[model samples]
Target: MVAYGFKRWFSPQIQDGTKTHTIRGHRRRHAHQGEELQLFEGMRSLHCRKIIPDPICVAVLPIVIISSDLIDCGIAYIEIDGLPLHRDEIEPFAVSDGFSPDRLRGIAPAALVASTARETMGRFWRSTQPGSRFEGVLIRWRS
Candidate 1:
């Protein structure tokens, strides 16, 4: 089984099934649909723990996150499997990835609560390099 690790704070959402997808950097061997996936917290650490029963990977798709020239203004373009996301869909998508403003209270700026998920995600993905582009994978489980 392919294993994926998450931070401890994500346990509640992962266990409750609210968060069913994860965005990650490319893997040498990408996960395939129908594969069993192991979810863990703190992999390779002494505090490691299983977060949930293994879940079947229902989908695995290409994902790209690009920061806009207006990145500082909270603008970004995101695509999944080559299709771009509509403006209205960003928030729900972000929530599914466990980045809802309320959930990011301490890790994100206080201004985030008043900002859109696009802003939150933009700031997050661009934390290190505001203009960087991220090519990754989106792994999902049936809800």
Candidate 2:
């Protein structure tokens, strides 16, 4: 099974069926739909220090790419079948596309657009430079 690793803070959101979509750098080869993804935590920090063995969450969810855009930079929205998690709950640090305020305004409703500037939801509009090959991927989480 294909496995993806996330930070400790965000991993639980996935396991609990809270965060359904993950926006990330695009992948040259995407995981096929209906494939079970092994969820791992602390993989990013594993190279830095020898931490305790991280437990692998048994929850495997099917994911799909629901949206892709190449305007400012390439981005893919992957959707997972799980309970919807609002942006406030996750509390992202920064918005990936904050540089393009107009884009955010255009796509999101006026109310949402207004909230994008607030601290809680600001990260959603934050600018994130696209990766060399792939912009990003949105992974949908499924219970």
**lDDT values of the candidates?**
0.77, 0.40
**Model 1 worst lDDT window (10 residues):** 107-116
Instruction: List candidate 2 segments past 4 Å from native.
Output: 47-121, 124-135
Candidate 2 per-residue C-alpha lDDT over 55-85 given as tens digits, one digit per residue, 9 for 90 to 100: 2233334433222234222222323444433
- Global fold similarity of model 1 (TM-score): 0.83
What clash pairs does model 1 have? none
Q: Pick the candidate with the highest TM-score.
A: 1
lDDT by residue for model 1 (1-143), tens: 79999876567789989899988887688678998899999999999999999999999999987776564535466799999998777678877887666776675456544355556766666664545688889999863
What is the TM-score of each predicted model, taking all chains together?
Answer: 0.83, 0.41
Clashes of each: 0, 22
User: After aligning candidate 2 to the native by TM-score, how far in Å is the CA of 35 from where it should be?
Assistant: 0.5
